[model samples]
Target chain A: MDRFMSLDRRALLAGLAATGVAAGAAALAPRALARTEPGTVLARAIPSSGELVPAVGLGTWITFNVGEDAEARDACVEVVQAFFEGGGRMIDSSPMYGSSQAVIGHALGRLGAAAPFSADKVWISSGSRGPAQIEESRRLWGVSRFDLLQVHNLLSWEEHLETLFAMKAEGRLRYVGITTSEGRRHAEFERIMRAQPLDFVQVTYNPVDREVEERILPLARERGMGVIVNRPFQQGALLRRIGRRPLPPWAAEIGCQSWAQLSLKFILGHETVTCAIPATTSVAHVRENLAAARGALPDAVMRRRIADLFGTL
Target chain B: MSEWWTYALSDFLLFSPRTYYRLFALHNAALWPAHLLALALGLAGVWMLVRPASWHGRALAAGLAAHWLWVAWTFLLVRYATINWGAGYIAAGFVAEAVLLLVLGALGNRIPPATGPGWTGQGGTDMGWPRALGIGLVLFALLLQPLAGPLAGRALAEAELFGMAPDPTVTATLGVLVAAKRIRWEMLAIPLLWCAISGATLWAMEAPDAVLMPAVGVLSLSAALARSFGGRRGTAAG
Candidate 1:
């Protein structure tokens, strides 16, 4: 944690070199400025309660499954600490991702009252098993209740959603949603989005995979459900696919330093997106991701431009 | 069920290669000096394979049984299960294999020693291609398999040794089974399954040496089948 603090301080001192430069300055010192000036991450309103959450939250899919290795576990702690310091609140995990929920619990235990917006999922096939799984997730997270709980991959979703809705009604859970990824079962997902009174919907959305842009995003907007974008980097495949390719010059206009930030900015640029959860293992990456939420999201033209350029790449 | 077909092998791999190797590193560190004992047992297995005496074969089976149980507990159940949710199932398989090996060893003298075409058996005669392949495999598992980590850009500390880690242990067991005059289907079942499982796992991690494990399984199983059928043909000719 202290290592990241010094990194921020070092970036801050670098940013202080160029003063009073208004327009092009953000592009010049995106990292330095974002590091020095904390609490500037763009916040979006959850359509259900109008409560704001940072547009860029941490996702723990493959990143946080370190599993009992003390050093790797501590490295995860640094990532969560860096996220909290970068003004990130929501941290998402699933019961399907082995040991991730426990690692998050360990981090939360270490960070004691870091005020995270905890989100987890109940992924069992049995409806009767749903409550026990969710309770186990809660125990693993060491939280009294999760801010949001989703039906993972819509496995036995109908039964899980009922339990989630009941939990929400009982004040045991704050919000209820359903998740699907890799664009699997979108028709079923959209059907549930229309049928259920869901508060949130987590789905895969990146520059390359834009299936949701046509129907799901528009429907989420129509249904007034907050949208959480998962797989913002396609589980790092997108970034690896764009390997070492220079960022487009227009990226600076949106305060994007790396392809990761550009990919995140593209997702968050959409009006319907409440948050984009990009999972990472590095604290520098967490800080860089949080920086994407800070300033100047791409407009409609810029977003199409990004999508077009990504297709070419 | 049709939806399940859409899923790829990589989707189920929840941990990274780095984390996977580090698990071994940590496991090896915690179980210091036991690696030497595993190596000694591996050498003993090789001796039994080459000698082909009834007592030696029985002792080898008991040694392998003990190794399977130890690996099932220490590595699979305690260590690998941390990252892989399916590891407990694999551990159960290992335990079952251990029990079968124990049964085979306990009923030693009742089962006749091999006298077929390639049978080195109590005669202590020259082992044909099957036993030769078996000895090569056991030696590779004992001496060469550990270096795979270092060769594949992993730390030497993370080296998976025979009898200690599942991959090399299974590989060595297949070697011993293939070397024997007769292949017991019950004893061969679990190690072969583990080979397929381990191969898929390493493939998902994009490890370059992923093919090596399953290749060992296929090669050994093929040799065993050839020897078994060839022995029947030799008997008919005689």
Candidate 2:
């Protein structure tokens, strides 16, 4: 019994020693590990005007769904703080994501002047409620002038677009756009891109999900509308698939350290994608994701390699 | 000096290679002492629970319950801060808490049913070293299998099995099985059967990708049911 107790004590001591070593290493590697500033990467000239923004942005789809509580509220504050601190600009939120818009509002209030870029959506299913819905979205985001006002999921597009057009004409919104994901409304996305004079269009375009590559991407490029890529991680499915696979050596050449960076870099590598917004709740994940915006992107060959890697799964 | 407590703490800390290496460098030299203290306390608590004294049993049960509550609270804080306020997150929390409660209940049952005693006239022998070792080994196997075997390749298997799929019927059937308690052991059978049937159907139908979601659904449900019912009953019965 005494021998067993001594062994247990030794084991505990060893475990603690190990934990201390890890924390010290993390503290030392900040410069090597810190995410790159957004401006370092190639910024697309927003074709409407010459406004340049980073090709990679952050999304708050799942991350910003912080319910009414102090800890959740604090987490949202940290997410926003990490995002802006890492030189992130665009933040996309929508009414469909429950309290996402409200959480952004709370974060923005805490962020004050540091809030970089804001783009939100209006999701009204019926054509008749366009005016009231836009007003509500304006009230929700607490911004009289929005950077981009998109018709969420192509809902009530005909009615909402009219108001959005008027808002853009009056300089209430800098851009007018529409978004659809999950390949559910590809036809609608294509039709909107081809026919309408949209300033932007949001769609899902991950390596695992390349359905948009065929039509919508080409149409967006042709129409000169900035494209936003959503579901870049396929909502955590991609990360789970990769598991503990170590990052390939080639990943460092393009500034990709984490799988999150590799995945986001793939989305940003596409020329047509103006910005890709991958969301996360943790500040650590947010910081890791923001690293994708720095350094060189994968060329055509690397993109194919990425696709091949995913294809194996 | 308890081997299992030492193993659990060491294993938990070792799981993260990056974290493990970082902690190795900290030379602060206090971590070892703290871990030793924690392990000693844990072993003492476990010993007290197995003692033939009524007061010790009650005290150990209270300690276990308090420990469970603390862990649950911490998990709740993380989940509530991370996930959206919806039925899914709530349901996930409920499932986690239920599993923890069931496991603790099993452990509680292992403590011999109380009778008039002062470490004498006990109805049965204590779980003793052998049974404790067996329980520890069973747990270690359960924890390690998901990382080592076919389960480790679940993600790829799931994707291949459910190619561009949305079979609501399969999803609904699995959901029903998950909620069913009477056929707890049968829940294990359903998944193995589903995987076999799905594999056969895929081969016979010449639709390799068609059975993906159903196969995945079955596999996941089967694994959960197996864990909930498998060695648990044996431990409780013992």
Candidate 3:
């Protein structure tokens, strides 16, 4: 990622410098300055309660399930610290992610800050296991309360949702939600949004994976539901696809400096998208991720232009 | 999606290739000394296969049993399961395979020498290239499998040597079985199944040297079936 950043800086400077005009360098100066400053990330209000969280969060999937190895654990500690220090508030994890929940606990234990908003999941097929699994997740996170608890991928949604609601009512969870991003599950996810009362909905939405753009986003808006976007980089495939390609010039117009920020900013541009949690083990990528939050978001018109440009790429 | 398509194998994959193999590399690093001892024992078993005797059979079984136990603890239970939950079951299978090998070793002279179309058996001999290839494959599993990791660009400390990593450990065991003349069909069961399972997993992960595992499975199973059902001494005991 340092390698990518060096090449990105060179391209930005060269593109501006090649113009042989002070105006070109002056134009990019503010956005470049904004990139270094903290608390610049865009924040959105959760429709259900008007609580604002940075539109950028950290996800713990495979990147954080590093078991008990001290070296791997230390690497994760660095990433968590980087994300938190970058003004990141939401740190999402789950028990189903093997040791990710535990690794989060390990990282947080090392940090000892007012840790990021704990967003966890209860992912089990049977209703009977929800309590134990959720409890285990809580223990793994070292938190008595989760800011948000989601039914992962909507596995046995009703049973888990009922448990989440009961927990929320009891003050164990500040909010309850359901998650689905697989295109095949969207139909059912849509039905759940209309039928159930939710504070947040975790969904997969990105430049290439715009399947949720049509119905899911609208339903979430119509229902006053907050959206937490996952897989913003399509599990790192997006960055790999955009490898070494210069950032689209217009990305600078939106305070974006890297493809990571561009991909994240594109998602945050949507009014319904309260946040997009892009997971990364590299602290450099974490800095790149939080930097996406600071800049001006593309409006609906610019979003389309961004989408069209992304399509061409 | 259909109601049944809730979760597929692809959904479970959360880590990247670097993270996945790095786990193996770390597993190898933490258990540095074990690799030397497991490899020496595995090579000894390979050597004993050439000089067939009841004692060699017993020693080979005990050696493989030891390797299986170590792999289950260090590779599967201790390391691999951290990323992939399916590894717990794989660990159990390794333990079961170890027990089966111990049972085979305890059977004494009943364990037969290497036999097939090209090798000596109870009532017949039909030495062929299959026997030669089987020996070569087994030797490859023990001696050459360790190099797969380094060759794929990982460091030497991260190399997945036999007796330390499950893939090479199981593959080498299957190879040794293929090179053997007479062993219970039950003895071949778990390792072959594991080869298929591990192969499918590595393929899904897009791991380096993934194809070799299932290749060993297919080649060994074909040889076992040919020597057993396609022989004059098919029903005869050692």
Q: How close is chain A of candidate 1 to the true chain A, as a TM-score? A: 0.88
TM-score of 1: 0.90
lDDT of 1 at B3: 82
lDDT per residue for candidate 3 within B151-176, as digits (tens), equals 86677766777888877777777666
Tens digit per residue, CA lDDT, model 1, B145-168:
999888988899999998889988
Q: Which 10-residue span in candidate 3 chain A carries the lowest summed lDDT?
A: A1-10
Model 1 lDDT tens row, A174-217:
89999999889999999999999999999999999999999999
Between 1 and 2, whose lDDT is larger?
1
Best by lDDT: 1
lDDT of 1: 0.81
Weakest 10 consecutive residues, lDDT, candidate 2 chain B?
A: B160-169
Q: Note the DockQ of each predicted structure.
A: 0.64, 0.04, 0.42
lDDT at position A102, candidate 2: 73
Fnat, model by model in order, equals 0.74, 0.09, 0.59
Off by over 4 Å in 1: A1-39, B108-121, B124-127, B234-238
Q: In what order do the candidates fall by DockQ, top score first?
A: 1, 3, 2
| C-alpha local distance difference test of each model | 0.81, 0.55, 0.75
Model 2: per-residue Cα lDDT over A1-313, one tens digit each: 0000101223323423464443333233332222333334434445444345555677877566655545566887898898777656788987667567777878877778754457888887776787676677667667656798899878878888988898889877889899877666777678778888998999988888999989888787787778888989877778888899998898887877888788888887777777788887789987787667776678778988887787676
Better of 1 and 3 by DockQ: 1
| Candidate 2: clashing residue pairs, number | 17
Choose 1 or 2, whichever is better by DockQ.
Answer: 1
